[model samples]
Target chain A: MTPLRIVTQLLEIAAALIAAPAFLGWVNQCRAWLQNRRAPSVLQPYYGLRKLFGKDVILAENASALFRFAPYAVFGTMVAAAAIIPSMGTGLPLSTAADAIALVGLLATARVFVSLAAMDVGTAFGTLGARREMMVGFLAEPALLMVLFVAAMISHTTSLPLIAEGLTTRALALYPSLAFTAVAFTLVLLAENARIPVDNPATHLELTMIHEAMLLEYSGRHLAMMEWAAALKLFNYACIGFALFIPWGTGTEAGGPAALMLAAPLLALKLAVAGAGLAVVETLSAKLRVFRAPEFLATAFLLAVLGLLVYLLLGA
Target chain B: MAPLSFDLQLLNGCAALLLLLSFSMLSQRRIVNLVNLLALQGALLCAATLLVAVRTGQGHLYLSAVLTLALKVVGLPLLLHRLIRRLNVYWDAEPVINASGTMLIGLLIVVFAFGLAQPISALASTATRSTLGIAIAVILLAFLTMITRRKAMSQVVAFLSMENGLFFGAMSATYGMPMVVELGVALDVLVAMLVLGVFFFQIREQFDSLDLHHLESLKETE
Candidate 1:
C-alpha cells in the first residue's frame, strides 16, 4: 500500500532470488563435508546458473506454447511465494493478499504447470517423472495442509504474518502439538523438495530421478529459470517453516530501514542452521525405493493428523 | 503440588502418545518392532501415572507407576524378546486385513471410543478423565490387533497391549483400581504369560509353525 512497504516487499523478493542458489550451494557443501569428500565452493550454484543462461535453447519438435510458458510461470509463482512469506520481516503488504492456503495454492500451481510441460515433450522419462511428481504432490499436499491447520488453530489465524506475530509476541511455552507438526513439516519439506528418502535431487539415474527427469528436455535459459525456481521454492519452504515454528528475530513492526537491517542477519543465521540440518538428514538417510514413497508420505500424513488430534485433545 | 494445568497437559500428551502407539502397533508388521512399541507405550503410561500421582498426592499411584515401569516396560518386553528368540518367529504372516485398511478401521474405532466416553468423562472427576476416550481407543485397537494377527506371538503381544489399555482406562476413569486388585491383575498377567509361553512351544512343536490359522482344524465337524 505505502511506498515503504512496497520497497520492503521488493527487497524481500530480490533477496530470495539472489540467496536461493546460495542456500542450495550451502547444503551441497555441508553434505560433501559430512561425507569427507572435497567440498565445492558455496558459489557453485550461481556459477552453474550463469553458465546455463548463456547456452542455446533446445525445444522438442512437438513442443507447444505451454512448454515455453511453464518455466516462466513456475519461476514467477516461486517469486510470488517468496514475496508473500515473511523471510526478513512479518510486516510485508503482500502477506495480506495471501494466507497459508494461498501459499499452498501457489506451490501447487507451479507443480501442475511443470508436470503438464513435462508430459508435453512426449518423452518416456518426462512422462514417468511427471507421474511420480504428481504422486508425491498428491500425498505431500494433504500432510502440508494438516500441518498448517494445526498451526492455524494454535494462532487462531491462517495468515502467515499474523501467525508469525502471534507466535513471536507470546511467552515461549513448550507446545507438544507444535513439536509433532514440526517433524511432520520436515518430512513434507524433504518430499516436496526432491530430497533424500523421497526423491534424490542429486541423482540422474534415468529410472530414479523425479524432478530432474521432468527437466531433461529443457535447456539454456529455460533450464536456468527452472533450476532457480526450484532453489527459490526450497528457500520459500524454509522461510515458511521459520515463520511458523521459529518466528523470533523476524521484525513484527514496520520500522524503518534500521529494523530491516537488523532482521537480515538473523534470517541468515536461521537459514544456515536449517541448511546444515537438512544436509545431515540427507546424508544419513538412504534414498527409499520409489514404491515405498506412498508409505513414507502416509506416515507423514498420519503424523500431521496426530498433531491435530493432540491439539484438539490436549489444548496444547 | 505441580500446577493442575501442567499435570493435565502431561497426562493428555501421554494419552495422545498411547493412542498413536496403538495405531502404530496395528499397522506394524515386524514382531520385534511391535514389542518395542509396546515397551514405549508402557514407559509413557508409567510417566502419566507418576504425573497424576504428583498432582493428587496419591502414594499408591506412585507405587503403581513403579510397578508399571518394572512389569510392563522392563519385564514384558524382555520376556517377549526371549520368546521371540526361542520361537524363531520374526515377521508376522500377512494380516487378514492389510495394514492401511486396519489403520482406517482403528481410526473409526477411536472416533467411536471418544463418543462412548463422553458421558463417562463428564461424570469422572479425576484430572486425567479427559483421556478416558484415548484409553478406550487403545484398548479397542489392541483387540483389533488381536483379531487380525495370524501368528500366536503377535496375538499374545496384542493381548498384553489390550491389558495396557484396560489399565490406562481404569486409571483415567477412577484414578486406578485398589492396590490389591492392581496386584492381582499384575500377577494374573504374569501367570498368563508363562502359560502362553508353554502353549507357544507346544503349538509350534505340533504344527511346526506358530500360525494360528492351523487352529481352525480343531473345530468339531459333522
Candidate 2:
C-alpha cells in the first residue's frame, strides 16, 4: 500500500486497458501481412469493442445468474491480473498480494466461471465448449505452474517483478534450464491464448473452435467485455513471458518520469516482436486435434519439469 | 513456546483432532460417513487455523480459516452429498483394498512421513512445525485412500481431504502462503468440487455405478 507503488499499479492497469485491444489488432495485422492479404486497421479491435459496448445485450430466457455475471467476473479477474503483473515497471503494488502461481490461479478462476456460464446455457455447443475448456485447463495448469516455478526458483522469490528484475540484471551466463523453460512457456502461452497448433481463434467452426465455442451465445456489451477480456488475457500472458524471458527495458521500482517515457517505446518494441513472432508460429503450425491437446500440454509439462530438475541438480 | 498457554494447548488439541479425523477417514467405508468425517476434519482445521491467527496476529490466517470452513466444511461436502443423491451411490461399494489393509498402509505412511518431514520440521520456524509430520502423513494417507477406493465419489473426497493436508502443511511450515495464494487455492478447491460434482453424474450415467474400475476400461485403445 505504498503510495508510489499504488500509483504505479493504477498506471499499469490503465495501460493494459488501453493497450490490450491494440495488441490484438496488431497481431491480426501481422497475420494479414504474413498471409499477403489486406490488413484491418490497427484500431479495429478497439472499434469493434466500442460498437459492441454501445449495443443492448440480448440474453436467452433460460440464462441464469452465472451466465449473466460471467463477463463481469471474467473482466474483473483479468483486470486484477494485469494490475499484479509488471507491464511497464517492476514495482507494482498488487505484486505483494500475489505471485506468479496465484496469477495462474486467477486465470483459472476466470476460466472456470466462463466455462460454468457456458455450460449453464444447456446448449450442445456450450456443453461441448465447457468440457473442452476444462480439459485444456486441467492439462495447462501444471505446465503453467512449473513454468512459474522455474522463474521463482531462479530468483528464490515468487514475486513476478523480482523474478523479472533478477533475470534481467543478473549475469549474462546462459542457463540452459531457462532456455528450455522459455520455449516451454512460449508453447503454453500460445496454447492458452488459443493460438494456432492447439486452437484456431480466427475460426468459428463448430468442431474446431475452443475459445470461440464458449462465446457462441454472448452478444452486445457482454460479448464486448468477454472479447476485451480475451485480449487482456493474451496481453497478460505475453507480458508474463516478456517479464520472465525478456526482462530488459522494464523500468525500475524507483519511479521517475524518464523511466516512464523510456518504458513506452520499449513496450511498443516488445509488443511488435511478440506479435510478429506469434503470427509466424501460427502460420507455420497447423492446429492439432482436440484429443491431441493433452499430449501437447503434457510435453510442455515435461519440459518444465525437466527444466526445474536441471536447475535444481546443476544450479545453472 | 509460552510454557503451555491456553492458546497453545487449544492449537495442539485441534491439530491432533485433525490428524485423528484423517485416520478415521482412511478406514471409513460408507461414503456418507466419510463425508461427515471430512466435515469434522474441516472444522478442526478451521479451529487450528483460527488459533494460529489469534496467536500470531497474521490477519491472512483468519481468511484462510474461514476459507477452510466454507469450502472444506460446507461447500465440498454439500456438493458431494448432492452428487451422491443424484448418482444414487450412498451405500458402501467394495474398496480395491480392504479397510484393515488400508489402515495398515496408513500406519506405515505415518511412519514414513515422520521420517520424511524430519529435516523440514527442523527447518520450519513455526511453533506448529511439530505437526508437520502429521500433515504429511495425512496427505499420504489420503492419497492411499484414493488409490484403494474403488468408487469415484469416495476418491474425489479423498482428493479433497488431501488438500486439507496441504493447507495444514503450509500453515505449519510457513504461516500460510501469501494471501492471494490461499484465496486462489480456496477458489480452486471450490471449482474443483463443482467440476467433480458434474463428473460424478457423468460417470454414473455412463457406467451405471460410481465405481471407478469402470474407468480403467476407458484406457486408450489403439
Candidate 3:
C-alpha cells in the first residue's frame, strides 16, 4: 500500500472514533428538540465518555477475565469495522481485505463478545439482557444480510468500496429495487442499534431494557470503551448505508486528495441529515412489544427479498 | 424509442406495486381496509391500462381504462362502502392460516405464476408482457384472500380484486379484450355486486351474522 492510502485509512478510523459519539449526541439533541424539550449540548456524549474514563474501575467479586477482556475486543472490532468501511474515500488499503460480508462478520464478532461477557457476569439482568440481545441479533442479522445482498447484486460485487464506486458512477435514475432495500436497511439499522421502535436506548427500566441491562455491571473505563464501541458501531452502520446507497460524495481513484478533502464535509452533512431523520422517526414511532420484534424483522427481510425479486423479474 | 422505453419502465413499476398491494390485501384483515385496497388496485390497474393504451395507441384500451376507472375505482368501492355501512360488518375473524403463513404462500404463488407465465410471456409481443406473471400472482393471491376470509364483505372485495388482476392480465397480453367483451364484463361485475349486495342482507336476516361459516351449518349433517 502507498503511504497516502495508509494515511487515508488511518484518517478514516480516527474520524470514526472521534465523530461517532458526537453523532449520537446529535441524534439525542434532535430527539429532544422534536419532543419539545430543552436540547442537550452536541458534545454531551464526548463529555460523558471523558467522565467515565476518569472514574475508578470497579470489578465484581465473581468477574472473570472474559469480563475484563470483552470491552477491548468489542472496541477493537468496531475500530476494525471503521477501518474497512469507506466513510470518506473509496481508496482505503484496509478495505481491500474485507468485503461487505466480512464487515458484517466483524460487527457480529463484537456482538458475540459483548453478549458472552454479559452472560459471564452471572446476574439475572445480565442473562436476561444477553438472551434478548441474541434474539434481536438473530432476527436482525438475516435482514442485514439480505439488504447487503441486494446491494451486492446490483453492483455485482461484494466489496464495500467497489459497491460505493459502482453505485456512484451509475447514471442518475431511481432504482425501485434500491428504494425497497433502503427501507429494509433503515429498519435493520434501527433494530441493530437499539433505537426506538425496537429498543429505547434512553430507557433504564429493567423490564424494557435490552442493551443497558447487559451493561448494568460495567463501571468506569471499561464502560467508557463499551459505550464508545456502541457509538462506533452505529457510525459504521450509517457509513455502510451511505457506501451502498448514497455514495456520491466519496472520493474515487482519479480525484485523490482534493476529492478526499471534499468528502469530509459531505460525510458530515450526510450524517447530520441521517441523525436528524432517525431522531424524527424515533420520536414519532412508539416502541414495539418485545415479542413483536420478530414480526418487525420479518417484514424487513421480506421487503429486502422483494427488492431482489423486483430486480430479477423487472430487471429494474 | 427513448420515450417508449421510459413509458415501459413506468408501466413495470406500476405492475410491481400492484403485486405488492395484492400481497398486502391477502394479509389484511380489516374489512374496510380490504375495500380500500381493492379501490387502490383498481386505480393502479386503470393507470397501467392508460399507459399501455398511450404506448400502443389502442382506442379500445382507452375506453376500457375509462370503464375501469368509473366502475372499479369509484362506483364499486362506493357501493361496497354503502353495503358494509348498512350491514355493519367491519372486521374479519381470524383466518384458518395466520398472516405470515398466508404471505409465504403468496410468495410461492408468485414464483409459480412466474414459472407458468414464462412460455406465454416469451410468445407475447407487448412491452408489458413481463408483468403477466405479476398479474397471475395477483389473481391467485386474491383467491387466497377469498378462501382465508370469514366475512362475506371481505370475500366480495377479494372477488373484485380478482377481476382487477384478470383485467390487468388481458391488457398486458393483448392490449385488451374486444369492446363488446369489455362491456359485457363490466355489466356482469355490476350485476354481481347488486346480486351479492341483496344476498348479504338476506344472509344477515337469516343468520344474524355476515360470517360465511354460518351458512356451512345449514348443510344437512348425519
Q: What would the TM-scores of all predictions be?
A: 0.95, 0.59, 0.95
After superposition, candidate 2 runs with Cα above 4 Å error = A1-3, B1-222
What is the C-alpha lDDT profile of model 3 across A37-59, one tens digit per residue?
99999999999999999999999
Each prediction's whole-model lDDT (CA): 0.90, 0.83, 0.89
Query: Taking the tens digit of each residue's C-alpha lDDT, what string does model 3 give over B1-222?
Result: 122367887888788889889988987888888889999999999999899999989899899999999999899999999988999988889987987777778778877888888889899997888888888888998999999898888998999999999999998888888999999999999999999999999999988999898888656463
lDDT of 1 by residue, B31-109 (tens): 9999999999999999988988898888999999999999999998999999999999999999999766776687678
The whole-model C-alpha lDDT of candidate 3 against the native structure comes to: 0.89
TM-score of 2: 0.59
Candidate order by decreasing TM-score? 3, 1, 2
Off by over 4 Å in 3: B1-4, B219-222
The fnat of each candidate, in order, is 0.13, 0.00, 0.20
Ranking by lDDT: 1, 3, 2
| Per-residue error (Å), model 3, residue B30 | 1.9
Give the per-residue lDDT digits (tens) of candidate 2, residues A221-252.
99999999999999999999989888888887
